[model samples]
Target: MNRKSRWAAGPYILWMIIFVIVPLVLIGVFAFTTDAPFDENSKRLTQEELAAIEEEYAETDEELPVTYKTVFTWDNILSVSQYLPVLFNSAWLALIATAICLIIGYPLAYFMSRFRASSQRLVQMLIMLPMWMNFLLRTYAWMTLLEKNGWINRIFGLIGVGPFEMINTQGAVVLGMVYNYLPFMILPLYSVMTKIENHTIEAAQDLGAGSIRVFTKVVIPLSMPGIASGITMVFVPAVSTFIISRMLGGGTNMLIGDLIDLQFLGNAYNPNLGAAISLVLMVFILLCMSITNQLDNGDEEMEGKML
Candidate 1:
């Protein structure tokens, strides 16, 4: 409302429009349109043009189609239908990773929230220490450790157990995702849980709430916003990741991100197809965020009604 506020917000608003809105518009244009291709044998070309082309390329058999004009079509989007299985695999893997994060993070977050200030700082630093390493390098370290003769297999060898294949599997991909994104889940839950006062929890206990009852009815309900935030944060990146799947799954587990990457930068070399896949991914992420937002709002409304 104030001029000072407007001035401060102007650059951020401009940045969003230039970066986000323009890119989405360009992707949509690419997804919905293509260069109208014509060949000498095609009926769209005139007979005279066909004769002229035959005379021109008589010495060689290399037939090059010419771009006639740009036309709008649904072919690019429709082409994505065949890749739905890849997309679904990405979603399923992401869901598994997110659920694992929540299971491991919820208790860790609660315990961290209950810590003394110094201890909380120490524990938080420990959680964040792994993230200081490069993402690619962290993944590489996992690769080294998960190899056939790696440390894990050696440990199993000492116990008279055979070394099982660990790397280049779906399990490896899921492990990478959980290891990398687990912190994203923990920090948000910790941030929200730390705000819940001890007196409120004690009051629930005073009213005959057992440990499980207090956690389910009071703590979990209050932490719904953080749960939603954590899911969105973890799921979005996990679903779109190509490097983890490629490296850990040995390129066999191609997710939608790998499919899009191949179309743009691999032997596929089709920017139009890549853009269409990116558009679909963007829509998927938005729908996820929308659902999370709805959950957050519903939780708020329920709390308001209770009060």
Candidate 2:
């Protein structure tokens, strides 16, 4: 690479080092280390009692007596088993939402790609309009709409269908995820579909292939990159989201993100466990993306072999 190109990449490399690498290093540090009381008596106290004692010490100016020993331990990582259920549930919901987004977005994307330039722009604008608003506000709107006495139930009442319990449920969480991330799926697929050669699809039709065959064999194969990208884009955020599950799922549907937040930022003062949870979540997300990438590559390999 030339000097100009190297210089251009310098800021990006610096940014990664400062933000990404530094945070990962901090998480590892916190995950693996814990403060053990140097005083034997302090170690014997319950966490609550210990906190009370610490508070008492803090209120007085006298150089708080005992120091804590920074000990390395596997307790934090081992404790993750207790949270496995929440983690698994988060993964399941994320997969459901991602699959729904793919099912809905693919058809919309294909149709959008077939439209004229002006019509295409209008559709793109509509798809992206929701995203221009605050994420929290969008979720709040859904929350209001799903309430028992909300506009949706009122409309249902008019139809004589009666009100239904829509808010604070697993279905609500999945709905929020799909609503928020559907555009991610559609845009990528649309971008890829627009680049697909009209001649290739025509060639399939010219061979005695029907519409279904042309779609399943030709168009779908060409759209694999978009499928992979969309899945990654939707799945990662959906799995880690606490707000959607908290607001829509009424905090009953606890996710990995919620657990981590509780440990770190909530009343619980356990950064160690939070960091470990964060590390595990990062691993799971990477594994998911890797599997997706492998599938995409396998598709490419199969296509190449056929060629």
Candidate 3:
């Protein structure tokens, strides 16, 4: 707000311009532009050719050509039909993964926050240690572990049990998502739970409230912000995830991320349609973020009221 603050913030402003603003502008431009002609030999317009085209357009144009449109024609929209299944599958799998993450991660985080201090540091280190390993290697490791005749089934065979199938299932997709994102859910929830003041719990007990009542009235309410953040962190990536789904699921599970990848790399060469699907996915991500923000701000307002 002041000159001193402006001076301090100048570097951050410049960094945002270079990193955040520039990438967004590029994505925005690409989202509007039609896919380029792949058949063209040179794969790029020459400077002189570009200048001639610009001159032709500028010289006799009755009205300016439409640069972009918010709403695309039905034909253009229909072109994105190939990605519908992928989009729906992504949404479903991510929702399931988010639920699983909360179910498992919440209890683990609560225990670590409540009982373990020195152990908590060690566990946190172990969780983050996976980051040191290559991500694709970790994912491939899951593939090995979950394949029909993989380690678990081999062990089962030794005990006279039949082979089991795990890989290439929806379950594997969820498992991969949960494994990759559990730490994200845990850390935020742990931070919030650990920061909770003990006096509030004591006050609830002093008023003869039971443990469940105290948790419901105090703990859950106080931890809402952390829970909201965890959901966002897990949900967004899980929904857009191609890496885990493609590796674990193979061709069986078609996720939105896989569709985008296919458009870019596989048989489908429709970049414009891919961009359309991407724009839709971006809208969905924004919707999730907006919901999280509202819940976060609402919790803050409620806390102020309590104070």
Candidate 4:
């Protein structure tokens, strides 16, 4: 890039430094440090000091406020073991949702990619139409459809199946995640699949490869970039989601996101612990992305060798 291109990136660099870099530094600082001890206005009192202060204040009919000195501690991160189940649940659910999205999305993308350009555009619009609505609203819409007396049950009732409990369950949370993030999986896969030339598949068929073999050996390997990108895009948000689990899982299925929210905003009110959880979650997401990148690289290398 030239000097002008570097200059054009100056605003983006400043924005990232101010918003991303600074906030991460602050979270790191808070995660490592606790309150400082013994300020001029707030001092830690010993038992004897407390007794003396109490005795002196007893005459005055006023009580002194107690304050503890802040210090660095590892308890916040160490205690994360207690919330290990929540982390596991988050990872498990996100994985399940990502897998479901991939299973459904790959076929859909493949089918859509074979359509004419105009038809593909129309289908793409339909796939993306739901996303134009607010995410909260879309999740709420699922709540209405999945609730016991919701539309799904009502339709099932006509078939003599009566209502079944659907909302406020792990399945509902997964449904919500899949519903919201499926587009993320589909669009990337479609973008990559559409770029594949028809002549490549034709050449494979000319070599006596069956439809299934051609798809497995040719189309999928070529679309690995989209697959990796979609997995990362879907899994990261699904793992960190709090609102879907809260609204759909009925607060019973507390994922890591809920735990972090509780630490910062709920009765827990511990920002240090929240920061620790956030840091761990960030590491998990980075690890997932790293694995995806490795898989993508491996696929590229294999493809190169085949060529």
Q: Best-fitting candidate, measured by lDDT?
A: 2
Which should have the higher lDDT, number 1 or number 2? 2
What TM-score does each of the candidates earn?
0.90, 0.90, 0.79, 0.89
Task: Tell how far residue 15 is off in model 4, in angstroms.
Answer: 3.7
Kindly report which residue stretches of model 4 are placed more than 4 angstroms away from their true locations once superposed.
1-12, 36-69
Residue range 36-80, candidate 3, lDDT tens digits:
322124334444665565677797745433232233234434666
lDDT, candidate 2, at 188: 94
Angstrom error at residue 182, model 2: 0.5
TM-score of 1: 0.90
lDDT of 4: 0.91
> lDDT (CA) for every model shown?
0.91, 0.92, 0.80, 0.91
Supply the TM-score for candidate 2. 0.90
Across 1-307, the per-residue lDDT of candidate 2 in tens digits comes to 5667778888999999999999999999888888875544555444676677688888788765556877898989999989999999999999999999999999999999989989999999999999999999999999999999999999999999979999999999999999999999999999999998789999999998999999999999899999999999999999999999999999899999999999988987799999999999999999999999997998889888999
